[model samples]
Target: MSLLEVKNLKKYFATQKAVDDISLSIDKGNIFGLLGPNGAGKTTLIRMITGIFYPDSGEIFFDGKKFDPVNDVGLIGYMPEERGLYKKMKIGEQTLYLAQLKGMSRKDATAKVKDWFVRFGMESWWNKKVEDLSKGMSQKLQFVTTVLHNPKLIILDEPFSGLDPVNSNLIKDEIFRLAANGSTIIFSTHRMEQVEEICNRIALVNKGQKILDGTIKQVKQDFKENLYSIGADSLPDTTGNEPYEVIGKKEQNFIVRIKPNDKPNDVLQYLLQQGVSISSFNEILPSLNDIFIKLVEGTETARQFQNIKN
Candidate 1:
């Protein structure tokens, strides 16, 4: 049920390859995370998908047909990292105008605006001008406009850029609501925790190439390094003698980077045999950030460390 598919996508600017042979798909109703640090070619790929730029060598498919820039363009709602809105216009007036531009009828647009205004508790401010709104408030106004058209596909870049925790959570909830109601979202953000929370599928890109892409769980498992985190009341004194190598030790816990060939339970038994009381024993899986750096540095580092026998 992929709503969007990209194949061998390539984009070159001058002498640089911004997107090289990238291939990925976005399933229906998925919140796919497009992640990369600055200058990683994430924006290049997004621009092509949104029709802002043409791919040098590739094809895009939307809804089982070859993508037609004009028709399928209306089916997508894109919120660029840089917010786009008329600063001098009233919130209610501007929101309705944008919705209408997206093909929403006047009456339906107004009704939906009212519903969102009440939900966001911004009914009182709707009559006010966008220029008078704070940065966070302006973001909400722009966000409302982006989703007002009820497009089947939504691409949000840095959607939570200017909001406080409360507002960030509010927008996050609405994003989940949209997906639940049959919208597919391509969410791009630098916040690993946010991706972990909301994104089902993810693609990590670096240096104009797709370094990795998969389900969140699958990606994490792929970057696995058999490590253990243990909290103990009395840690064994292995100053000179123990099979386990402690990577680090904190207040009440020690982070052990285990040999991949060693079983986790075997490490636990060795600790217990040394009369150490284990309070908590947990595996150390790679975080999205960790995985990103590993991939960009070259996936070979992960391979070398994946099967070490101690």
Candidate 2:
């Protein structure tokens, strides 16, 4: 079931269209990735979703019902890119206060805060002030407070900002655990590798418009260019071009692009006839980063060409 849905969402700042007629849906228990480069209007769209900014035009539905900013806001746990914790407050006290603000009872908030502190190995830092902690420590403390109320929908922007590899894995594991238990997550980051690691579905926006949306596998398949990597002691030489093009080469390895209507077996047979020794051959799949750059650049190039034509 879809936990959140946005239909024809539009947000404008004077003459600037920050979010231009965007629509997306998040299913229950999904770790959906909202991805884009800097200034791609991702932040604007996110603000609208979290009720921090009202859309100039559109409808937002939560769990199949029209979402009301007044009531539905409490159902979301948002960790914005900017830190909002009190620098002067002690970790435990601040955590408890934030939980209470989310409508959790005092007893429930304290118990949950203690449990989370223990899990994060910050039990000893309970009385420590936020200003005294390192950046990574502060990040963990803020994360604990964000999720303490156990909201159904969680939005984490750059959740791994300050942590080293070890601590990053710790939080990654916790995110997986949360999804397993029925929480829907919206993960926003510029890191493509992280998105590939954790997100099942993704939406990519560029220039205030959604340029791509689908499962990771589907996106990769859609962008595949029928390229393959092959290793051989020697390759047949047409220098100019043949049934396949050797687009790249290093030592005995070659990256080949098969021409339209040409079969892989035919290429192999041609190499065999020429007595070329084949070592290894595998299809080359495009990475998410490759696809992202390709789509965004392709859009820009087309826009430039249109401008020139005018």
Candidate 3:
């Protein structure tokens, strides 16, 4: 089931259409990646979803009902790219306060905060102020506060910023745990490799519009170059009538693209008939980073400012 749905959502600023007619559905228990380059309106779309900004046009549905920003806000946990913690406040107190704002009672919030602090090995820093912690430590604290209320939908933008590998893995594990237990996560970041590893479904937005949407595997297949890697000691010279064209070589593997109207079996058969000793064969799919660049390349590196008419 879809936990959140945005239908033809549009949000405009005086000089830019921040989000323009974008639509997407995020299913329950999905780690969905919302990917885009700078000025791509990802932030604007997320703001609308989290009730921080109201769409100028179109509808948003939360759990199948029309989104009520006032009441539904509590059901979402948003950790923006910019940290929102109070510099002067004690970590423990600030966490409890934020939890209460999400509708949790004081007693429950205290217990929950303790549990998370202990889980993240942050028990000692509770009395410390946010200003005193390093960037990575502060990031861990912010993540805890975001999910303290056990919200059904969680939005994390650049959640891994500034963390070392160990801490990054720590938070990554928590994100997976949250999704496994039924939280739907909207993960926005510029790290394509991380997106490929963490997200099952993704939507790519550029210029305030959604340009691609599908499961990671589906998107890869859609953009595959029909190239295959063949593990062989030596390749037979192409006689110009071969079913595949040798594109390149990597170490012991020969990279080839199957000719149109030719199947993998046809290539294999042709190779075998030539007495080529094949060890392994596998198709090579384009990486998300490759696809992302292929789709967004040639576009202006920076979005130009535009005039909007009322």
Scored by lDDT, the top model is 3
- At residue 146, candidate 1 shows an lDDT of 84
CA-only RMSD, every prediction? 6.7, 4.0, 0.9
Error of 2 at 151 (Å): 1.8
Better of 2 and 3 by lDDT: 3
Structure candidate 2, residue pairs in collision: none
The order by descending lDDT is 3, 2, 1
lDDT of 3 at 294: 98
Give one digit per residue, the lDDT tens place, for model 3 in 255-310.
Answer: 99998899999999998999999999999999999999999999899999999986
Q: What residue runs in model 1 are displaced by over 4 Å at the alpha carbon?
A: 237-243, 297-310
Report the C-alpha lDDT of model 1 over 34-56, residue by residue, as the tens digit: 99877677888988988889998
Model 2 C-alpha lDDT per residue in residues 1-310, reported as the tens digit of each score:
9999999998767545678889999999999999987777788998998898999888999978998877877788999998768899988889899888888899999999989988999999989899999999888888888888998899999999989998899999999999999999999998999999999999998877898999999998898888888898767777654669988987778999988878888778877777888898878889999988887774543222112110
Q: How far is candidate 3 from the true structure (C-alpha RMSD, Å)?
A: 0.9
lDDT of 1 at 108: 95
Which candidate number maximizes TM-score? 3
Question: Native-vs-model 2 lDDT?
Answer: 0.87
Winner on TM-score (1 vs 3): 3
Q: Between candidates 2 and 3, which one is better according to TM-score?
A: 3
TM per candidate comes to: 0.90, 0.91, 0.98
Better of 1 and 3 by lDDT: 3
